[model samples]
Target chain A: MARTGQVKKVGTALAGVLTISLIAGVVFGEGTSPAAPAAPIPPVVAPAPFSPECQGGSTEIVTESPLPHVAAALMKRRTVRILAIGNSTGRRQGGFTRQIERLLKQVVKGADVVIINRGVSGELAANASLRIKNEVAMSNPDLVIWQVGTDDALAFVPLDEVRETVESTVRWLKEHNVDVVLAGLQYVERVAQDDNYYRTREMLRDVAAKEHVMIIRRYEAMQFIAAAQDAGGGYGPDEFERTEAGYNCLAQYLASAITVGAFGKGMSARPLRGPPGSQPQQPPQQAQPPQQQRPMQ
Target chain B: MPRQSNAIDFWRGIALITIFINHVPGIYYARFTHANYSLSDSADLFVFLAGWSLRYIVGVPDRPQQPIGYLVLRLGGRAVELYAAQILITMIAIAMLAATATILDNPLLLEWHNAAAVFYDPIFTHIGLAALTHHLGYFDILPLYVVLMAVAPVFAVIDRYAPNWLLPISIAIYLITLIVPLPIPTWPVEGQWFFNPLAWQLVFVLGFVMAREDGIGGFVRRHITVLRWLSVPIVAVSAYIVWNRMWPDPTLMPQPRLLFIADKTYVTPMRLIQFLALVALFSATYPYIKRWALRLVEFGSMLGRNSLIVFCVGSILSLAGQITRFVYRGDILVDTVVVVLGVAIMAFAAWLPEWREQVRLRRSAQPLPAS
Candidate 1:
């Protein structure tokens, strides 16, 4: 018994020494380090005014003709900051934000565009809505592009609940004098099957119209692209929306809308793709004079 | 079962509850779980404890006096039950998602968690799911568990005859998988399993090997007090590491980001070490905790006793909570109600088996006057 006790003591001591050394080694070894910086998104060249992807103006500018706040910042400061918040759509794998920045750089001469991503994959808009206020306050971007409703649509969240969350969030953004842009859902083949997908899309459109904020017509443009794709042999057989090409196209559409909205009718006095809900025709022949988009405030 | 009152069951129950909340995306109560404050979360704990539980069934120093074939068969039977459970639960989840999707008129439900592939190509995907090549989101861990249990007997036999080489061999396979980065691939989506068994088996082996009282488990048990002291700083530093998102960035680390990154799929070394340190510390303090705390052991013990059943129900209930949060606006009150009701239901599910056992004991205690 005495020998056993002595052996146990020896074992305990050896174990203690070993553990202490292990802990010390780990504690000192590779101590806390920071997350690697986000990949540098190279600013590339701008797309043509009417790429196959751009339809009229993919986004209908909601704030009055001149985006005075963004314009003022761009013209005087030659710098504009945009906060892109959403789910997987906002943080596309191909660096959609980089494409947007490059296009905006082309649109605004000698101007610097800083776009920040505030997206979490698989995050619901309801959750995003709760967190947006803090993000906006921290980043204080000139414009906030909120990609919403896709996850909610997928999660089986109620339509009214979706509307209420969005409508109220938009109201808060507007009240804070943050120019809000509601980017709609991604269009996919499955979307055709889901009634709530379009229901959520329409609700966003209605909210944008009601609040008088700009919204990128992402779903409609993607639908147009998907239809064009079905006509055969454009961008391979992959789901157009899931592909990198789809995200780049989206970036082009959104960038074009922002440029048109920011610079006013003077630069491109071009005709839009079509008037809101007009005949399904091609781009207007002449660059008609656009609204004198000064800020409503 | 001399009315076992170990901390394993209690911690496992906690892991179960935490997993249930975290599985439900966008739940208000999720942030309160261990993941926010640690590199490893409840999943790590659950898997580790799972491996530890295997030792109780069959391992050196305390293995049951059963024939090797019987042991193999017993483990095989468990694997079969788990496989069946996986299929049944997966189908139930599908039905639930389908019902919600149809009610809300959203086919997008099929898209989340790669379920869209199943719906889009049901015949093939169903075949894949049955064959254990495909797994659904939030319903994945069980498939991994099934694989581990199936593999346990081989390790158990090796453990009985050649314990020294068991862990080395297991670690070698783990490291090889990491180096080659081999993972069991999933179908229809063209991705690998979320919890890669190749990588996770390391934790399982470590847990099992460390549980044997004649080996490291004995050493640790003997030196638990000193190790517990060492764990204080380990836990403190780990908390800071997690909160600050501090770790050697995976990209900066040498080859194989799987080994370097803080990932759930691979259970990276950083997460593994921290979790081990945590278990070492926490397990040592279990006895003292009971002196000062609530009936932490009793409720969790009951739930832990029937962990598998409770887990299945808990997972289903968690989905229901998410749907509830969606259907009704998510707020403090709504979140509170969901969590409260969810826990209550889990408790009832856990308590049912225990209640039945207690009633049997009471009846058994009654002297059979004529027997």
Candidate 2:
């Protein structure tokens, strides 16, 4: 009797299941395979316009080689090669690495600069250090522009560890005789107010000075622009007024400064100041015009 | 078993409340003080809770007969209710819009004035379509809930027949959804879409499986400390990534790859892990909070019991409050008054239906010896 009861229960449950399935089928099965073409696959290589900056110097483009085990390739009687490695910030259209490529191409004049962007967002300094050999060395570029540290600051990686990581990275590049440009990032908002930004910047600066590699004062340039805007009566209320313009100006300044600092003399010769020792004082030069002088209102 | 897992429902109620707070449009404590909490995070939590709750309520062994039928009815009923509610609310919104146009003498909603052009834009049209389809508004979770619940039986069968293969299948599906693109259109072009099912299903599955396990409650208790400690780094890393990537653009459309990876649409891996971390942290510290909340006695239990009613009414009230904002034109005091009054009125509205039902039940229970 008990066995029969169990069987009856199971049968009832199965019947219920079938009924539910039928209902679901009726509801969701409508247009189950709606007529449409397959989605288009994104192109692997997006068409990028070459910049006018890479025309005058010995510019090395670092990118992944197409054919394996080919150190240098002759494509239509011109060598095509590139080295790509860094974080997501390095992979943007206007990111530091791309800017470097544009400038390098402009300096070399008609030399095809194949700059590869291997920047994955959210990568930590430790991860970069671990992957340096495979991602950077394997590419075998003549020059490497290593832009990192943003993730490290937010990750709370120790200042010493950040310096050690960068130092080792530079050493590895130098071992392969790969010229290195160690780029520094500047403060945007809260980061500028915090002590960690300055500490990280100083650590990078010290490493660059010790290693005799090129140091780009990206942070100082940002401060200069921010200070200039603040001095000229505060910038607008929105983020675009505050950081977008600042980031663009800073990025432009960094690219130009790195090129100048590494290869030749340009605007980078100007003295770079550190973060304010205390709360920022009112700009030494105040706003002049009466129209601009409206009180805090 | 009669599915002795009401604990998850309590947690789900809390998740729903968080979602309600997130959907409240105007500036509140969440805006100025805790702006870091994204609307996406709330959606992820809700999806996870939904999956978890399904497993708890429906997938137990030695269960009642007609489980699948019961589940389907419950889901279908909720969907129907949602559609009906949305139609009513949309009409109310349209009416409110028309009334405001009259009061302001703006002619924004009047077809003759041609100011209806703005009102007839995709924002309203899409919301209108959503209402018609029973999809609710952009922030509505009911449509996604309906879809997820419908699929639960299939998952349950897989759980029963091939338990060992479940995790691998789920992970494979999740990875495919993550790497491969699935383009689903959401309305308003710029308005937020609440949840995505593809990435989100993993959380639901995880919750479902965890609920089925014999030692889940004990396991949670045992690993509380380790889980709490682990949450710190997880939160920090996720926050850093979100701050760097998400804050730059708050708009819903033209979503970047990071948003896809975050996957509020269908509970992506990152969201699942983050939500689990949050749950762990909360459960570990819940004793202190439970003690305090319990101290409130009558109000706490009443609020907890009628959470669904509170949520529905709260949502409608928030919309009313938003309309008042238009009427008052950004007067902070007036907005606050409107919101407070809206909340009271909604709470009262929720009480009315229940009161009527209670009265009917009392009358039905009256002695009928003469009859």
Candidate 3:
């Protein structure tokens, strides 16, 4: 009996030691080092329009044209088009697509900014590829703003699949001469308490870089707004509205910049400046002759 | 035999009730639901109890073949019943999805149909393939239980003949699972299954081994005295550990590498200790709780005796509650009220058949006494 009791005590002690050591080893091991104060994440910055002369191409100005004369000619010749494709969040009436469309209409006015919103909610990038040709390519879009990766993240899509799908989609779009603007995923702080969303966003950024496509940096913008709201106090109905508005502003900023970059002097003359208080004012809007707006067929 | 005053059923009922509430999303308390106390955990607890009860129902040493066969048949029948229940629930879920998609003008089905290729990938094709080798979802526990039961006979033999070896074997299995890497491909990702059957088997087998102890009653009596004193400190320590583990200083994030062990997968050594400590702490106090639990268990056992009927009815009621929540969107108060009423109706349904049988038995036995 004494020997048995001693053995039990020894087993208990050994269990305790083993458990403690294992925990210590893990807690003290590689990942646990105090994350070096993350280099302060740079705030998202809108791209500035380049001067027409700096574009390394011939510049032409058509006067009293219903569209930016240069862009009007390009549109008549069927040159520049843009497509927005994503899930339901992208398709909402007041969602990213509408905001981008409104911004394009305002900025490029008569430049024939054909913005198509082909967003189906809950659809991952994998499915988007299936219908890409008919829905996106048929328009012969010169630029495609891709807002995906959220549904894929929520659905537990493997990181590699996410990378491969985005890569293949980018390759396909580029092959068809469509300039790709990979829209980074919005932050899902609530569901992503486990850091899954952050990981997905990082992967998306990596894909954008690897594919050599422009990135809209929506993830950073959303995180910025979310953090600002949190700092100001707490979440409320108004705050949610403000966050949505901020996301819209982000979409507008990215679309306008990419459009200006792609079409150059052919881009419309509307002010690139957002509504008052939308973002930190950076540069003065360049002046151009007003052009009449025409309804898109 | 009269229903034993086993608190096991009460605990089971509580587990089920908690799980029912946890599944009802958008509740005020929804955010607080953790892996330890959710449906998967409840299933784990149920399996452990099933193993324990198997030993209890069959004699410890060598039981008669007839009784053994009866027990096996009962358990197997229960498993079959569960499978049928799962199939029914799946159909109901599909119907609910359809209705919600149509009435809410939601594009959920359209989206699902469009993404069928991604959604319909075989379980093994995904990460943690071993984990997803079984169906992927919150409702896959029944299949796991069925698989576990097929091996229960082997476990029964060990329980009956080599009881002392059970703990060592279970410990060895758990340690191996901890030390060795088993990457089970799961849909969308590769990781271990939620329950980590290898690690969890220890608890089930421990329960089985405990049920066979000859001096359980005496042990309870003695432990009850010590438990009253020890429980306070144990609880305090447990609480402390939980707080420290979950809410460690934000500064610790920089050293995320160091916190790799904090991950719950693989039953990390700390988590194993914490969970075992909780179980031991709770078990030690059982004697004091037994008096009240005994009576409740009698009530619960009466319901649990026909658990299949109760489980099926309970699941349907729970589904109705979920559908109601999905339609209503936000009204947490209404959701809670409806769920509570639904649970009551299920309990009553579970009770009626057993009550009627009891009455019939009493009447039949009375006539024999008069004769």
i-RMSD of model 1 (Å, 1 decimal) = 9.4
Q: Encode model 3's per-residue lDDT on B238-257: one tens digit a residue.
A: 46644343323222233222
Enumerate residue pairs that collide in model 1: A56-A273, A65-A293, A66-A293, A66-A294, A269-A287, A270-A287, A271-A287, B110-B116
Q: Per-residue lDDT for B207-238 in model 2, tens only?
A: 77666554453476667688789987876676
TM-scores for every candidate against the unseen true structure? 0.63, 0.47, 0.49
Docking class of 2: incorrect
Output per-candidate TM-scores for chain A, rounded to 2 decimals: 0.70, 0.56, 0.59
TM-score of chain A of 2: 0.56
Query: What CAPRI-style quality would you assign to candidate 3?
Result: incorrect
The top-ranked prediction according to TM-score is 1
- Across A161-253, the per-residue lDDT of candidate 1 in tens digits comes to 789888888877766767777778877665565577778888887887677666766676655555555654243545523344456666875
Scored against the true structure, residue B123 in model 2 reaches a CA lDDT of 58
Q: What is the lDDT of residue A45 in candidate 1?
A: 24
List residue ranges in candidate 2 displaced over 4 A.
Answer: A1-297, B1-13, B32-40, B62-67, B107-138, B159-170, B187-194, B213-222, B236-267, B295-308, B349-361
For model 2 chain A, the run of ten residues with the poorest summed lDDT:
A1-10
